[model samples]
Target: MALHLPQAASLPFGSLTKMLPLNKTSSSVSAISKSFNATTSLKIQCKAPSVIVSDQSQQVSRRSGDFKPDVWHYDYIKSLDNNYKEHAYEEESRMLRAEVRVFLSDTVNPLQQLELIDTLQRLGLAYHFKSEINKMLENIYSVDKFKNKQNLHATALEFRLSRQHGYDIPTDVFDSFINDEGDFQTSLSQDIKGMLSLYEASFLLMEDETILEKATDFTSKSLRDFMSRNPGHELTSQVKHAMEVPLHWRLPRWEARWFISEYERMPNMNSNLLQLAKLDYNMLQAMYQEEVKSNIRWWERTGLEEKINFYRCRVVDNYLWGLGMKEEPHVEKLRRVIGNLCAIITLTDDMYDVHGTLDELELFTEAILSGKISVRHLGLRPDGTMVEKRQA
Candidate 1:
């Protein structure tokens, strides 16, 4: 993220007789000429310099995927309406979530409270009730739930969520699971719920957490074994999924998008909560797609698709990456800027890798740094030779 702006006397790419300074030493006229000759010599080493550049423009960037274009139509995406803006929908969702929130407040059983809290989080409704959730966790910690555990699932859930929210719950809280033989209690593996909780909990491990590291290994193996024994069981799909990507590591929007369907299938799932999640997810997707369309418009206006063919023209992927970084709907314009920046950076990487020769790269680097060459100043001749433009 270092931005260097150099001092300059000229604004076009050519054989520089002198270059003024911002960072580098102010070299004399002869020295500048020598540097220019050296750059020419570098390009001369390549066979058919412009031919190489042209050939490279035809080559695919290493990072470019061969995937086909996305099938999502803009009109179809824009047509999606989750009714989240309507008064009735909002109040209904709020009331349903309120039931869960009230349940969180009224419960005396720590296990019951933590289970509901965990469920609220996985359902993507926790963002609406951070204060209640924090208070609940603080109450759990105040009771010293970390030190003693009557239930394995409850204990592991507490430890995982505590650490996740930066509670500094030591990894040794799990030491009880290990036996005198320096291994997990073999009997513990049989409790499918406990094993699954520990399996998800293990993903919260930070660096040098030996106990959690071992816990991860233990839980993973146990869950796989449990899956083998309980084929086509109710928990089979969930157990398999947990092993693939623990909840902690999953991307938030993607998790919500996925959990909406999974939560709908749950036997005792709150219907209002499911509707809210679906509305929220669809609304966000529509916002993101709108931003994406703006990015496509920006890209097309630049005519980069026709002009720059060396890199991946993944406009949607660019927007998604920005969304992954910061997906809040209020920042649609910011996401658009980030999307364009991402796309240009990807294109630049491809240009540097194959098309931009050393001389061209150095010249552009120095020129760009020095606020020169605002225009396309370097062009390739038919025979693959560099021609520097002299601006009028």
Candidate 2:
């Protein structure tokens, strides 16, 4: 729960250079040179000096990532079925969306409106009501009026949502909660909901925002103390989750998956919102399954997974990464493109890290830099040998 900002680690470049296989006389270099020499028609020129292989015992040893086999197989992925994709469900979803829109527009209380907006966002339904949410946030920001200045939850929620949507809310808004000692009042610690709100909002702090810096320390400590003291409290679970990873940093799809279950347990949860979240999530999950299946087919067609045995077969994981980047259902094509690229990149990275010797890697890098290695010509054998793939 300690709030530590990320810092880049300095690599030991000097020591790394000493360990590189730059020696031209190394047996690995000779092995690679011999491998390249065997494929004369392939047109790959090795950077290492060629050595005549009098003995056939010499072979380049490849490293393995030791990664476990993927548990999600093609048949399992294809079997994933959800009724939410049907037209009947679509009509129901549309009607529920309309009802939610009315509810958003009709909410008169500013705090209630902010809470609703926050709920919509966490539930991953924000995209469906983007315009309405934008308009509501604009009115809220422009008015610059809150009935209760001392209300920490309202203030923090407003600050977070507004700043998140590009509004420059000043950090001084929390000054009222500070005492003569220039610290958040001790009494505020008793309000678990407010502490949680402020904890999340503090992440929106810009460079040199000392007030928020103080707020982060105060709220984190207060929330942690509350969790230790009241472990069985209803809000303890939430505080623990937020402390582990703040809402701002959580993955949207994963967050929605978690919040949907949590939202169901709420006493005052809206039935329409809960139903829409579940249906929408299922529909999107169905789409994701199909997209991953398509990408896996594409990967199989490329033959990289078969041609290169040293790498990980992670088509589903790559698709999940792509989904994380663009979760909107309408961006299926973009997601597929991202998934394909991620797959290629992952394979290439593993090749460089686990299989390729320094000489081979350097030659490959040079070929790439000189625009000599095209996708059509690039091929590798199981024995870490490069070969040319002729067009059929």
Candidate No. with top lDDT: 2
- In angstroms, the error of model 2 at 243 is 1.7
Q: List, residue by residue over 122-199, the lDDT tens digit for candidate 2.
A: 888999999999988998898976534989999999999999999988988898898998889999999999999999
On a 0 to 1 TM-score scale, where does candidate 2 land against the true structure? 0.79
The C-alpha stretches of model 1 lying farther than 4 A from their native spots are 1-100, 330-334, 373-392
The lDDT for every candidate, in the order shown, is 0.60, 0.71
lDDT of 1 by residue, 312-391 (tens): 55555666666666656666666766666666676677667755657778987897789674323323233322234457
Which pairs clash (backbone N, Cα, C closer than 3 Å) in model 1? 50-384
- Compute the lDDT of residue 23 as modeled in candidate 1: 14
Give me the candidate number with maximum TM-score: 2
- Model 2 residue runs over 4 Å out of place are 1-58, 375-392
